[model samples]
Target: MSHSLQHEPAQGVTPTLRLRPDTGKPNVRLRKQSDGAYRRHPDEIKEDCLSQPSEQIKLDISVADYRVVSKRDSEDTVQRMRESMKDIPRSKRAAEVKCEIIQIIVMPQLVDMRYLQTATDDVIERAVEAHFVYSSIYLIPGLSLAASMCAAFHRDWSWNARGVYYRHYYSPHWITGDHTLWIPTIDHDMFDHPQERPRRERAQRLLRHALDNKRWTKSEYAWEADAWSDVFGQIRDDPALAADKRECYMNMAEVYPVSATLTGKSEMAKRIPDASIGLATFHPQHYQNAIASYELDSERLQALTLHRKTSLISDPRLGESDLVYPFLVYEAKGWSGDPRDARLQACAAGATYLDMLDALARHPGPSGKVEGAYQFAGSRSAQVFALTSFGSHWHIMVGYRRPRLKREHAGHPGMSKTVYLYQRVWSGLISDERKAWELLSLIDQIHEWGVTTFRDYVIRHLRSWHKFGRMVWKGDAERMRAVLGKDAATSGQFIIFSLPSWADGFGTDFKAELRQKSGRLMLKRLIDEQAGEPSITCVQGSCRARGYKCFSPEDFVRHCSSVHDNHSGESGRSVVKEVFDQAASDMKETLQELRANCYEIGPEADTSCAEQAWTMVHDNTCIESPTRYN
Candidate 1:
């Protein structure tokens, strides 16, 4: 039977009920039964439904027959009912049903009342429970009534004890830092250089076109793709913005390891920005030429190629996926997007950029001067600019890691630590003519700083490390001259053998043994060269041209087996066999001592090698454009 009540019927009120349809009963088709004996007879079910008297049964019940109550009264009644239900037996059908409480919190009202109502309705239908059907008018309000109710209930919950009231709040226990200085005031002097006037004028002209054409619509700009490519496309494409060959690259939704959360924290995910401006990727051949000049020993080169080592690459992440020492990051959203989400995303990206700068300064190079190498305003931290926007409103923020301060806390015992800080400097509506030019001028200023100060700091350290490597190479040659005699050591065809990969922190003994073995191999090869019997390349079934010409003889062996060997010698080529064996042995032993630890001194010389090598890959790679506009 079907009956409706808010909680319970009022005193002396008797509500009429009606039998449910036979089709609504549970199906017996899938049940396991012995010869169908457990199933109820169809006639018995039909007779029971028909036994209800016509006068007592109400077939069509409507809301007009029941008393409607306010939401507060309804909530009070539900609480009373819940208390009353506790006394009922556990076996009762009423006590067996479980109810799930779903709360539908609404956003604060905006200028467009209808838009707010529609968005709330869409969220209720799609984001909330989707399977249930409601019959009462209170549960499902009509459009006109819903709009008025939404406006009446509009209240601002923007501020909370922890931080801004975004959908997700950072947990205090998990997130440690002072976010009190959340937003910073804009400093006009930061971007007020005399050279920015022409670029600002150009930005004004392009922005005027976008607004006048009305090319950005609410529907068309529902996603960020249109906002980036159409509305702001001109700003990035402007020749003046990229005058130093630095350009913005879209890195939408690509996760960066630098932004990973602390252990046991599930509140924050890895940071992925919409875009960033940095040293742009160049042609493949230029990259090859640059890496070819690095002349790294075999172990470091293999680790680099496999992306197992990121120290030499100056990449903040495990692999070399992002620009080295990028300076600016961005996050964007369309008309229907949430501004808080955009702000949070921008903060995360900006923090990651700042963290990379910190890493560059902290990484220890062989020269020992690499530590604390990047300092701005006497601090090791560097500033990173962030641009975040939702719809026509845009904001500029500067992110950096504040130095930790020594202080006492009553509640906690440790010293005060500071997390990455992303402080908003300026924000305004892009539709305003004056604001657009000011924002674009700030971008130009940021671009200049990125290519000059930040670029110079990174390049300086990389070049220093490369020069140190050259010194180490020279020292190795001198030591070889003393040990293997000048003629053999200065031979134009000496091999550069590769040492096996060793674990970090505990390979001192093994490293020393390898160095001694490397020296012994060079001495033995010098003795073999004293005979000088025309070398094995002149023999049959060999490559038959000259001595080995590569740093790795294993590669040469593969070259000979594929190009010269006919497989027809069949054990008759003993000299060729000996030559291949000696070449393969030489590939793993010669000149490996050159890559020994920087602490290992040379023979009567302080020529410690480059334990970790760094190079200026960007120097030989990036090609600049010849023209500049403005």
Candidate 2:
């Protein structure tokens, strides 16, 4: 029977332990034999884990019987597992990269990052507390830095990276300079008449053959004349406008011959609606020549597969059933202090578009939405983003929906955890080529950790730690490993925020600071609208904080709403609120749930301030409090 054993240690090391699988013990002390296998022992903690299994079809993790080892062991074990898979093809390999948390490095000055060492656990803990703050989310890039590591270890950004191929960019710093990623992509053409180009091209060829054989009718000739008129607004023979571009011009019969999906986290394989877009490319036909010439420019775009409904721009002439899930999406924007809301709104629009196309999978009848366009927002599952990019930033905020419960999750029934990650913004991977390249290398490392597998890792190993009592990475060996056999495991970067200085249960220290402190009240009230709770004040200002919680989030609209005069309130509260409101209004969607006051998520107050970050520079427009310096 599975039961706890007496306390024991091997050579003064108090390591925890768990069985691999096909075993009975819930927790047991295991030590690696000299020959590299595991055996249970009563008095010794595990130092080394079992070597990787020989069968290499990207080993699956059994959610049940999975015991979460401590954070350090988890990270180390995952890193080693990923290293072992370096020789295997990513499509069948377990993981792609190794990532570790460290003190935020200051910007380049006579720099060499290859030799940087890992920081002590205390340094990591204090750094997270002093620097990774939610208030810094107002500074869009800072939010992105907090999410950088998660994005690096995922496979969804491959779609946008392909877009870079369309534009001419040559950066030598990249490991794969010219070859970023590739997939089967299609682009459609746009004209006044929805199907005008295809029709005219069809007519132009048909007329040549029909008239040559004297098989044309005068009535049909008139109809063809109208089609040509539609094709050419003013010019008589401008075939260039309707002509197909190089990669896009497929003689329908030859498409299957040339089309192939790239292996692993390559977006072609995931094929989500927004990411797996097909384009209609064109070569300019200034003067109709029989020979093709020049580079391709896409005029119209089509969804490779329908998401909720058919895309109006989707070619009625061809089928698009092959594309299924969106693996990556890119939305480029210029730099700004408030870019998050617009970015999220764009994601919302893209998601709405995808839902309509997905409806085709279940209900393929005629719907109000067309093939090319979809409505934005006010729909169920609106914000479920998998891999979406905003400008230069990368984010993995979407949840995956399994069409059917074919696979089992760790402790829950079927694929239990919908949310696969705890971190969000990776837009901060710019300006420093080293940082960006590091992220790219990491992405290349764990490129196969796609939607379903990512969900498995989160439930089987990541969230499993909570099931055991270990809250932080205290070097416990048994608490670290789980049933997961290293195709990929949790990034373990969350350990960066697990220190007690950060809030754990029911809320974040950031929320506490906002609700209890005198400044940023306007920001707090606005946040409270979406995320307030009946939280008891655990600290001295507990009474007033609970009183504020009693009122609806809307009631505390301004700092002075509770007090008539500015003189009656603390000096910085009203002033700071006014300045912050003016600054943060531009990016509301990003801060919608900025304060995660959950014990499971830890506290928001634990995030350090803006000045502590290397990527985000302080503009000082949002702060009015003298205590902010303190």
Give the deviation of candidate 1 from the true structure as CA RMSD: 26.1
lDDT of each: 0.39, 0.26
> Cα deviation in Å at residue 305, candidate 2?
14
The runs of at least 3 residues in candidate 1 whose Cα sits more than 4 Å from the true structure, single-residue gaps closed, are 1-201, 209-216, 219-272, 281-318, 363-379, 403-418, 465-630
Residue-level lDDT tens digits of model 2 in 1-630: 888888557787868778668767656654322210011221232222122223221113221212222244457778998788778897764355555552232211221112212434344323322222212111111111212331331122221111100011112221122112221111223223554454445435433432332222223233224322422222223232221111111111101000111122211111112222211233355225542222121111122111112222222122221121223333322222113333333343344333432332232222343432212221122222323322223333332222211111122211122212112323232223333333343332223332233223222321222222121111111111111111112322111212121112224564344233212222222323322221111111332322222122123334334443323345554644453454334223222322222122112423442112201211222211111210
Model number with the top lDDT = 1
**Candidate 1 lDDT tens digits, 148-257:** 33233211111110111111112222223422222223355644566756655665664664454334445323434544554345545632222121232212222111
Model 1 alpha-carbon miss at residue 35, Å: 74
Query: After TM-score superposition, what is the CA distance of residue 343 in candidate 2 from its true location, in Å?
Result: 5.5
